[model samples]
Target: MANLFLIVLAHVTVTAVVMLLWLARTYMKLKGELQVLKNSVQKNDQYLAGLSSSARAADSRLAFIDEQLKGLSAKLSAFQQNEQSANPYNAIIQKIRHGASVEELMRDCSLCRDEAVLLMRLHGSGPG
Candidate 1:
């Protein structure tokens, strides 16, 4: 009876030691993986800091470009308005320069296609 008890005790002790050894190895592997994760996190933090500042600078440049586009749009609109405003007087000036018969020009009073054609010819011919 005594010998059987001792044998059982020995078996339990050996099993416990094996379990402890496996748990210790698993703990070491997990600790190494945790260190690797910590290193990656640190590197990401530095990259983000640089990226954030560059993004701010890009936002500022975009604002300036937007302002320039708006100014260009306003100038284009004003130029169009001026062209329309000057059309009527410009047509009369062109007619006079054309030397279209004064009688015909006077009769039309409104001055018309004949004067414009004559004007283009006069301007295009030069000093005639």
Candidate 2:
């Protein structure tokens, strides 16, 4: 009976030691996986930060372009108004549309020969 009791005690001790070793190995593997996850999260955070900065820069550039477009629109509006007020070719256009000759446009509208010909091509009654 004493030998039976000793044999049972030795078996229990060996089983407990094996279970503890398995627990240790599992803990080590889980800790290594946690560390890898942490590193990946850090890299993702850095990449997101860079993207955020780039987005900010792009927003600034877009704002600058918007301002430039507004300025160009205003300039175009002013130029269009000036062109409406200062048009010098209305009479020449009318004469060309009425089938006036290039020589007549040059003589009456004080246009050069090339200017008369170009006007005829653009606004004349006949094909040019």
Candidate 3:
């Protein structure tokens, strides 16, 4: 009866040791996996930071381009206004194209004689 009791005790002890070894192995594997996950998280953080910096730079460039476009739009408006004010005799030129005489251009456009003759020479169908 004493020998049977000793055999049972030894079996339990061996089983306990085997279970501890398995537990230790599992803990080591989980620790390795956790380290890999930490490295991946750090890489992702660095990539995100770079993207943030690039986005800020792009935003500044876009703002500058917007300001330039506004300036160009203002200049285009001023140029259109100047062109409208400068060519008040477009109707008289069209009339001259239809063979209107210099005297007719002077009468219709209220221009001086020299201005009418110049328009006739420039836009008329034939020589002034």
Candidate 4:
């Protein structure tokens, strides 16, 4: 009968509408989740970039420190060479500190007795 057919048609239309609404809600939830994932990935990329920059800066500083140390080493070597060659008094002081007598200092260092006596009194470890 026509009445039976119309009742069946109305039930089908209501069921289809409910199915469509459920599908739309599911789509919205999936879209929100995708957005959250994208944001997390962007933050991770920024953090990695900052770490890379810091590592490069540290490497540069280390290189500068290495060059400064090399320069200081060279200057120290030159100063030592100059001191050894320029100062005979350094050797005389070593002899005096080792308890050399005035006579030995005068004979070996070509110093006058008065000068030898004065050095011994000033720098000798033992009795002058």
Give the range of the ten consecutive residues with the poorest summed lDDT in model 2.
119-128
Q: Over the stretch 1-128, how does candidate 4's per-residue lDDT look in tens digits? A: 89999999998999999999999999999999999999999999999999999999999999999999999999999998899789867888898887788888889999998888788777885545
Using TM-score as the measure, name the better of candidate 2 and candidate 4: 2
Worst 10 residues of 4 by lDDT: 119-128
Cα lDDT of model 2 by residue, 88-119, tens digit: 67767877877889888888888888888888
C-alpha TM-score for every candidate: 0.63, 0.68, 0.67, 0.55
Q: Candidate 4, residue 3: CA error in Å?
A: 10
Candidate models: Cα lDDT each: 0.74, 0.89, 0.88, 0.88
> Candidate 2: which stretches are off by over 4 Å?
88-128
State which candidate, 2 or 4, has the greater lDDT.
Answer: 2
TM-score of model 2 vs. true structure: 0.68
Best by lDDT: 2
Give the clashing residue pairs of candidate 1, or none. Answer: none
Question: Which wins on TM-score, candidate 1 or candidate 4?
Answer: 1
> Model 2 misses residue 125 by how many Å?
4.4
- Encode model 1's per-residue lDDT on 63-114: one tens digit a residue: 9999999999999999878976867556545555666454545465554656
Q: Candidate 2: count the clashes.
A: 0
Candidate closer to the true structure by lDDT (higher is better), 1 or 3: 3
